[model samples]
Target: MFDNLVADFERPCALDIKLCRYYHGQCEDEHKRKKLEQKSNNSTSLSLGFRICGMQVYHPETGKLEKYNKYFGMSINDNQAVEVLRTFFGNSSNTNLHNISNTVRNIHTAILNQTDFVFLSISLFFFYDCKKTDVTPSIQKTDIDDQNVQAGFKVRLIDFEKAIASSDNKIHQLPQRIKDNINYGMVNLANIIDSFVIEK
Candidate 1:
């Protein structure tokens, strides 16, 4: 089931190797782990974008791909994005709040950076693990003796195949309309993250 597309080769190749390592019990530091989660999520979008641009996805280990957060789950619908964000970060205690906030900020940064290209529509997909988290309405206050619990996050944009450059040569520059849309998206994303964090 592995179809090799010209443009999608690099990202999937790199990501698949890393994922294979992770699955085989290669542990990574927190920061690198967070970054790798983000990268793995984005690799799916890159794959779709390449296909939209007429490149095929090189299929390798379809079963493994289907098992990762990247391929197995459904896309977060517009209405669900906010709820998903809330659930993903809502249950963390104060100590974990900082890391969760950092993850949200990182996601915002990634979205802003990637959406520089014109896009007709974009959606974020949540990780299966994050989706499984129990989001209680009220999180108990952090106790001094409590052990640190860091919940990893994975969220990335999709449906970029409809995306295109505003101009043939100006691939890096997006038009005003696209910029406005991206700004709006980021604002909503930030609001969702803020709604979940219990202010200390």
Candidate 2:
């Protein structure tokens, strides 16, 4: 199951861990609780982009098939990739409607802690588009900060916002922009980052 999710994208590791923790009752954040509901209702393209890539998706209506969006990594058609998404979704549990509305805000807490999903997503893109550019340069600085996160050095995050932005931009290809908005909902995003000073 874990392998399938990882094969679906770049790093389902974080998602696996988050979902695991949630299943075991570990994560508890009101903010995250709110967003998980949103995540569940988010667009197929957004979800698919984070889950797979390198392909075009279409929204099929009663008699029409329209190109929805395009991605550049992994695929819904690959055996391994298909397995991952299936495994992840297959394991999703049922929740109490009352708890979801009163005790908790959404169905799953893991989807809201998005850093893992974003990181793993970068990996999938590389898996499919390794030749686009060297990904190391984009990640090196942040990696150093990740190490210093425990050292009291505030870390700033830039890559995350850009990732979400790029994802949103990719969905504009739909002819009905409002329909796209309905699928994605509102786009107010927060960047989970801190400023860090290196004492070199």
Candidate 2 lDDT score relative to the true structure: 0.24
What do the candidate models score in CA lDDT, each in turn?
A: 0.36, 0.24
Question: What is residue 23's positional error in candidate 2, in angstroms?
Answer: 35
User: For model 1, how does the per-residue alpha-carbon lDDT over 86-144 read when each residue is reduced to its tens digit?
Assistant: 43344355545554344445544654566345554444432223222432322223431
Worst 10 residues of 2 by lDDT: 191-200
Error at 164, model 2, angstroms: 11
Best TM-score goes to which candidate? Answer: 1
Stretches > 4 Å off in candidate 1: 1-89, 95-98, 111-116, 128-152, 169-175
Candidate 2, which segments miss by more than 4 Å at Cα?
Answer: 1-13, 16-73, 78-83, 96-159, 163-200
User: Would you estimate the TM-scores of all the predictions?
Assistant: 0.37, 0.20
Assess the local accuracy of residue 107 in candidate 2 as a C-alpha lDDT between 0 and 100: 13
Q: What is the lDDT of residue 69 in candidate 1?
A: 40
